[model samples]
Target: MAKSQKLLTLCIAGVALMSTTSGPTTAFANDLPANLDQASKSANQLKWVRYTDPAEGAFSMDIPVGWQIQGGMFRFGYFDVRWMMDARSLDAKTIVRIFDVNVPPYTLPTRYTGRQGQPYSRPQQFQMMVSRYLDGQSYAELYAKHRFSDSCKIMKPRTSDWVPTLPASWKDDPGGRGTQGSVSFDCDTSDGPRVATVFVRTTVYPNGLWFAAPISILSTPDRVTLAHDMVQHMIDTWEKNARWEQYQNEMTKIGLDRIQAGFQQFMQQMQAYHRERSAAMNQQVARFESQQSNQAQQVSRWGETLTGLQDVSDPMTGTQFQVFSGPKANYYVNGNGVKVNSDVSPGAGFHQLTP
Candidate 1:
């Protein structure tokens, strides 16, 4: 890319970062005449404007005018970021957030040895993700408890409906996808009782890590519907900036080359440093090896767990195996090393496995 183009891209990104974090959203949300709290009565009057991330300009979303908006793509560590934002009514009754920062990575402590097995604890981080399955509703309920107050009560609506939106492609992802879940809650806050409905979406990968995000709308019980509509509108209209993505990709490549060069130099220095620490480092390898073997045993199980699979045991041979969990077929095994799923018996000596 030309130097001028690079400079222009940075300038645009700079503008976005300022706008989102500085909360110029309240100023740009100018198209609507009615306030967000009042617009709840007649959603048709609501107007929206594009809110772009100043950090990378990677994404943009249409948000209702007049809402007090802040937050944007935040860096997590080297080469990773959680793109998100928070928007709310001037009255502070309605809020819409894209991602939860406090959620932990899907990886379990058991997956790692030594200090890596511990949960991430900085001096204090109020929110985080967990190893829980995310089919949407269950996660939504969990999210409610964490994002809201602990004592918050989930109210199961009589309708028996819990539909949330998800992409069919999520299932095809290497990390299996989860169905969206929605749940409403009556939460008690310092101000008073408020009703909140949260929707969660997630996808789990083979490494026991999952990408998940939540969309929530909260308000007084009387205003919940309005908040819901506003949140839904944003979800439906959210868009990504392809140009910004290209710029990021270009920058990433440039940065990666620089990092690789620096890393090579660092490694050379580290080799000498490690020789001095080798005597001490050797002692820890044995402990890690023991844990590594245990981790090996759980590899398939953990993969199944993250991918929504399960283990089955064949009574005839007293052998066990893992397969996708579903009611579609019976899993069987013969003298083979493992089992396979079939509609009927594969042959004699092939016993159906018990789930």
Candidate 2:
């Protein structure tokens, strides 16, 4: 349970903290003026442009010139970027996703701190918010290109109503050639002898992974193959990408697990080191305390020795007595130090005189 929790947290944190950007989208027909319905319809034909870049570590097919790509900008880690593109004023669109083989640090620690008056003000805080919303989450987009003499249209049908009419051999492919799932749709109109429509279905994975499946339908059977082939190629590319992504994710999981184990081992080693250091310090302190105690005992013994030296002994009498002197010691009757002369030695006399 603990391991599971840790894994979940790590994955969620990674997704939540990924970087992403948003740009303006081509205005849909609903937002246009009521009086210019025909002009609005024609203008809507230009919905997507060509996107040449790869996404999620996958490459993209060539996009014809005169088209611009738009929508769904995704940034994973520090260098991975992914997005979908719609040709402007046309019913055709391309989706581009990229992932860097090698990535640097996603962001600095200071970026998340929400510091006051800093260059990256609230960066961390913003990242936290985005992560909270997007962690462990996935998303996808349905895109298309429509070439109209004067107009184009993009549609997003609700999930319950979406069912694709696929080609004959769609089921035979290893990828979900005929399989249907919860999908999003895109439709485009082109400028030709008559009206034509191209349909797209997009399936998204919650982990910020997605696949685009397109089914082309035209008024005549002759144009059907071209439409089918175009979408078939896109689907093939998406399938390749999905498989590659799966492989990458598997490898990433294995690598992260190894790293976590290493970190745990390092932590264990550090804890043991700290314990050993603490014990050594305690032993040193004990030794110092013992030395101080011994020194104190020696000082007490020296004080006792000084007290004993203050007592004076009378050699002749073999008695010990306290010695006292007033002002300065005076010479006795002789020059010898402390001489007892015959003149002062009449009888055994003791005097406490100020000499």
Candidate 3:
């Protein structure tokens, strides 16, 4: 297993530093009690009951009587399943199907049966069976098909195994493996005494056999008829129930809904980002145009100041010279014969042509 730790540094302006550690230390104390022995004992002594609502298209055994059922199925790749929590056990108890081991009810089209003792490879039979679950929708159809066979077999061996049950107070965790699948439970049935949930996992294979592992959650007492009921439910109800088809369909829909929601959110964010970028680009272009316009006006003013120049001939000596003047009497004259004057101006009143 590869584990990577990431550290993030946050800087808040003008905020007082309350503590240096960013870890969730306070939650650790409250989440688990101090006495391990008491906790263990309490977990074993708990009792839970079951409930069913056929109208809701869902049924769970040995769940806490009043716990709400978030009635739905979810799927990831080849696996499709449903789950419920026990209310009396603080929603601690749970039940889930890791795989369906029942073979398809269709006749074998070829002599090569894919069952372990078959003489030849039953590729056609294998493909047909896998096709039912895949329904021509998955990207990796063959892979999922193979997984169906592998996971089904692993789940077969441990189905009827019995173990101690958990108390009604402690919750069960079908510990997550991050990839495959897990289901945990704590329940009391009319026949089985009390049983802590065992984890069920499945692995699919391409050849034919579907392997599954159904391990008891180890310490749950065999109270009432839970163990027997659970086993029978697996072989009788789960495998034979027409409801599995609906469960599969629901799971497929849930997977698609998740994908669609993700895609929609991605597109929305991208559109917003693009709009912001376009606005920024337009602002930059506007600033550039304004600067160019100002530069053009400066050049136009320079051109106008230079346009006022004219060549003039002196009346007294016939000396020609270019002279330029502005509105404020600022002007330049170019000629050697122009008379030197102490001061020169006219209209604005100037004395000129004085030696």
Model number with the top lDDT = 1
- Per-residue error (Å), model 3, residue 113: 43
**lDDT computed for candidate 2:** 0.34
| Candidate 1 positional error at 264, Å | 3.3
lDDT by residue for model 2 over 1-355, one digit each (tens)? 3554343233323311122334423433233332322212222232222332333433243322333323333443222323343423233322222211111112222435334323321221222111111111111221122322233354433332333344342232222122233223333435332223434333223332223333323222233333334334333433224554464455446545665677799999999999999999999999999999999878855765666322345544454544332223331222222433222332334422122
TM-scores across all candidates? 0.57, 0.32, 0.28
TM-score (C-alpha, index-matched) for candidate 2: 0.32
lDDT for 348 in candidate 2 is: 39
Better of 1 and 2 by TM-score: 1
- After superposing all C-alphas onto the true structure, candidate 3 shows an RMSD in angstroms of 21.0
lDDT of 1 by residue, 12-80 (tens): 232111111222223435445546455465345676787777666767778777776766655433223
Off by over 4 Å in 2: 1-242, 306-355
Ranking by lDDT: 1, 2, 3
Model 3, residue 156: what's the lDDT? Answer: 22
Using TM-score as the measure, name the better of candidate 2 and candidate 3.
Answer: 2
lDDT of 3 by residue, 1-355 (tens): 0110000000000000001111111111113323322212222232333333233333334332222222222211312222222122222332222222221211122334443223332221111232212211121223233433322322222223333222221112222111123233333343232334343333222222222233232223422244334433322322112464465445445545565567799999999999999999999999999999999978866775678644445545555665553344333223443322223343332223311
